[model samples]
Target: MDRYVRSTRRAGGFTLIEVMVVVVIIGILASIALPAYQDYVRDSKRAEAKAALSLVAQRMERCFTESNTYVGCYGGATVNSDSGNWVVSITESAASYQLEADTSAQHSDGECDPMTLTNTGATSPAACW
Candidate 1:
């Protein structure tokens, strides 16, 4: 009877080793998932920046069609990407323009940081565009 009772009590709950093993498995899965999730977020932000850049360029084109110049295309005001992840700065001349999307948040992303677009329909840091 004692043996039966002892066996029943032992089986009623998980052992420390079992709990530890489960914890380790969870940790491993999290370690793998966390970085992948971060990468996805970063990529999405980049895509947003790219789209914002394109939209700004399109707006500039429309302005140029009306005014025949690029100087006042963006209205001489500060611009930020739609998602607020990038700040857009324009370098313009009478006939040409360059748009730069810069942000401290993406500074660590050397390969894609400071994405650029030109009036000639060119994009820099080719891997990012």
Candidate 2:
């Protein structure tokens, strides 16, 4: 009688099905993570814009206190956020002023694209502020 022995060697690498499963998992994770990250970045940019608007509003108030007008305030400083994420535009009269912060690029911020603040400490789109 002859005895048979079983082969001990096995394939060392992953099979096609295993590799495909891993790829699918990675893709799913990325799909979820990418959107969350983008949203976080947009929200941070909006926060920066809000801060810039507040600082400008303060400067306007100071100008009114000293010169009794909001015109030509900020000492001719550039009307943009330090990060360049926002472009500020001012509309002012002798007593009151409005500062609007619009996105500097095409990054659409559907929630609050143009944030507004006034010299009287009022902010628009109350949910955002």
Candidate 3:
């Protein structure tokens, strides 16, 4: 009578199904993270544009207060407001200066809502316009 003992070897590595499952989970997680990261990047860009525009606007406000009406803002600063990519633009109207910003300021397809910030910040950027 020969008695058979179970094989002593244990599973030594991951099975194909286990590997695939892990890969799929990682992919799903990456997919979820990617969009959030993109949105965060876009938000950061918007904030940066706002800060830059605010700086220029304050300068313009000072100039205007001394003279009345916008005296123009940052130019020749190497930051093009009309580039075909991310950009910031401030246009001076007859009574107020408009600070328009977008995540992608170019392509002419992005939402470029003008953030009308008066030069003097009289209303201040934090206030109206």
Candidate 4:
């Protein structure tokens, strides 16, 4: 009777080594997953910066059409209300314009720090767009 009870109890539970092996496997998987998730988040934020630059470009074009020049457009604004993750700026003259979207203070990083779009519709770091 004593032997039978001990066997039943042991069979019902996992050994320490088995539990530890499972834990180690989970830890290894998490280690691999975490960095990939971070990259995905950073890329999504980059999209926000790109979109902000495009919006600013459209506005500048409108301003040019109305006044035949890009100066004084947007009143020299540096922040775009439409995009929350980027700071937008424009440098322009009667002939051409350059629009830039720099990462906001809180989200700044080297991967996609600043995205640019020009009046000629050229995008820098073209892979980002």
RMSD in angstroms, all models?
A: 2.8, 2.7, 5.5, 2.8
**How does model 3 score by TM-score?**
0.61
The global Cα lDDT (0 to 1) of model 2 is 0.83
Candidate 2, residues 9-59, lDDT tens digits: the string is: 996999999999999999999999999999899879889988999888877
Candidate 3: list runs displaced more than 4 Å. 1-7, 72-86, 93-95, 102-109, 112-129
Off by over 4 Å in 1: 1-11, 105-108
Tell me the TM-score of each prediction against the true structure: 0.86, 0.85, 0.61, 0.81
For residues 44-120, what per-residue lDDT tens digits would candidate 3 score against the true structure?
Answer: 55555566667666677776777776634443232433333445566675467655544443333233343334444
Q: What is the lDDT of candidate 3?
A: 0.56
Put down candidate 4 lDDT per residue, 1-129, tens digits, no spaces.
Answer: 776564444447889999999999999999999999999988878877877787788888898889999888976679664647778888777788888888767878675667888999998877778
Candidate 3: give the clashing pairs: 61-119, 121-124
Worst 10 residues of 2 by lDDT: 69-78
The TM-score between candidate 1 and the true structure equals 0.86
lDDT of each: 0.84, 0.83, 0.56, 0.81
C-alpha lDDT (0 to 100) for residue 53 of candidate 4: 81
Model 4 CA lDDT for position 7 = 48
Tens digits of per-residue lDDT for model 1, 23-111: 99999999999999989987987888788888889999998999999887775555887657788888888999998888766445667
